[model samples]
Target: MAEFYHSVTLIEEKCVGCTNCIKRCPTEAIRIRGGKAVIASERCIDCGECIRICPHHAKRARHTHLSRLSDFTYKIALPAPALYGQFNNLDDIDYVLNGLKQMGFDDVFEVSRAAELVSEATRKLMVSGKIKRPVISSACPAVVRLIRVRFPDLCDHVLPLKSPMETAAAMAKQEAAERTGLPPEQIGCFFLTPCPAKVTDIKMPLGIEKSQVDGAIAISEVFPELSQKMDHLETVETIANSGVIGVSWATSGGESAALLNEKYLAADGIENVIRVLEEIEDERIGELEFIELNACAGGCVGGVLCVENPYVAKARIQRLRKYLPVSQNHLMGGPIPELMGWEAGLEFSNALTLSADLKQAMQMMVDIDSMEEELPGLDCGACGAPTCRAFAEDVIRGGCEKTDCIFIYRKQMQKVADTISKLDGLKQFSKEEKKD
Candidate 1:
């Protein structure tokens, strides 16, 4: 089994165990045990859904702080395109890019530039028809992990291309090393991430042995300082190179739209993406050449780490898009052919299977079904499981017990009382007969 480390974690003291996270979790990966939320490492997709739903602010994304920049001789910031939408009424994208440089970064690399390269590579892959039908986008790490845990069969449909963040990190490091004559180890590439899933991806990337990104900084953490710097700027640098096609990748349908002349479907939000994946698994949408699924609503703009409201951020991205030139006129660059080398190593992590032995797993399934029949059938999270059936499964798997169900425990206590009453009645009747 592969080791798992998640970027989305719980701050135990703050959690009230209110079932907010467990109920909303797309995967029933959360359980309220000992009055604190416990996340099953294997089941978690690092989607940050819990982080969004928790009222106590207990759930948080683990990320590297700006202070870590001092460790490296040269620090480069790889800002996600979604970062541009964080500011209110921001006119030029360069302001955000320049702000990053002012915040101690030696250079700022736009992930959108890498997105353009990914778009081209994806277009070529789709045109070639070398892979399976309805190829899924690999841009969203959360969605990729969702498929790994819940929709393992659909793993083959996931595109093997490296995410824009990874590509940008790789390029940034190499370019920085070359320009500065600094050792690659001394030049650190830090991703400005809008989501915890990206942080997890940087730490443990799929389809590759390791990530090129040295660290990740949450967008929400940088938003306030960056905004102040942008406000104080006298003149913003004209260094924004990515065009509309690349920049638009910040929102939903943007990726599909960029892949011109293709029959593509885009789904945003974790629930909607799950529905689309289900349809694909059922072969209902086989004719579609590609499918883009974003875990966050309105795509990256809705990430838990993002500062602005998703709808407002989406509007900002649209307005920003209007100022950019067309893809052909402002082509940033093409795919780095070497980055595709990771494709060959791509394989399903198979995080979903319950047991390795077929016979044992079959028996466990039978036990789960039997146990579920005895449950209250409420699908309530009171028993620390999302559904009654899931609770039964957990019981059979030894993670929980049938007594954990309040109804079941009450019924057992009632039975005990009835048995005691019967014994008392029988003893009193026998004593009366003896006296007669």
Candidate 2:
């Protein structure tokens, strides 16, 4: 099993105690306390929505500094498709690839190439008899983790395939190592990431045991230098082989459009996807074959770490799409035979069943119900948890004292009133001094 790590953390000093993130959090993982925000690890999906919303720039994504590349004998850059939309008038893709090489990389590998391979794999899954009616895309690691942690029953539907980024890293490293006659560790395969989720995926992979990616640098952190190079440099003609469909994977509905499967329904942004998932759970979306959910609003291009504005980035992607080769009609034939049965089974440490026992979980639910009955349902988040129900869970888990609940405070006040009423005879003797 993959030992997943979420080292891409929110710096508490940078946070400004904003409720914007609290509202955007899909898992309701963040809570404000002591004039600061805190992230609950068990509940965080690492979707990067908080990173995108913080106004004071308190939210920052940690990535490998360019200085670290000097230690490696040969460095390879794997730019995600979202990186392509970061620059204006980037007339040629080679400008981006060559620019990375100039920025200290020995070579640049297009992540879109891996997308090509993934596209082939996706097509094969559709044709294969093993897959059920709708095979969910495993491209978004955050979505995959969300399913594993929050919606364990829906895990089986995730297509058993590595993401384009991982596939690109695997292939690029293998080929680069073979050519350079160096070990895998010597050749660092760094991804130019679009969001914190990808950073988390690289550090602590989801469905796979060990991720092929070595490290990632957020696009927003690297865009300044990359954009400068594109401004004045002459473009070189490179293999533009990553199919059109593969390039499309950077957008919200790119996967569905690439697969061109009619039964599929792709929804972008975390909250929107959750709403759809709820409908699915309620059995309202039974007719749909496949569902694609992207936590980022405009997909990877509108990710938290991109330099270009969301609308501009999306428009560039659309324009960039016209120049690429079509994936469906490509001459690459079909997926390799090995890819047909490729299965990356569930990657988890402990049993994916609820963390608490069924009895305990039910009791927690009951406690939450009682707390809601007693307290106001304003969702003020004043008690440190995002909601009153969450506060109740904290009490049940022994993380909080019951007296801290607002409703309990009110009840205690009532008890004090009753005690004072019983002491009314003693209060009459004290009133004479007050009148004088």
Per-candidate clash tally: 0, 1
lDDT of each: 0.87, 0.75
What's model 2's overall lDDT? 0.75
TM-score of each: 0.96, 0.89
Compute the lDDT of residue 4 as modeled in candidate 1: 85
Predicted candidate 1 versus true structure: per-residue lDDT over 210-288, tens digit per residue: 8989999999889899988888988778778788888888999998898895689999999999999999889899679
- Model 1 residue 270 CA deviation (Å) reads 0.6
Candidate 1, residue 342: the lDDT equals: 56
Candidate 2: misplaced stretches above 4 Å?
1-4, 16-20, 234-239, 328-343, 347-355, 421-436
Give candidate 1 regions above 4 Å deviation. Answer: 328-336, 341-346
User: Which pairs clash in the backbone of model 1?
Assistant: none
Model 2, C-alpha of 360: deviation from truth (Å): 2.8
Residue-level lDDT of model 2, residues 308-366, one tens digit each, is 88768888888887776676323255555342233467643232233457887677677
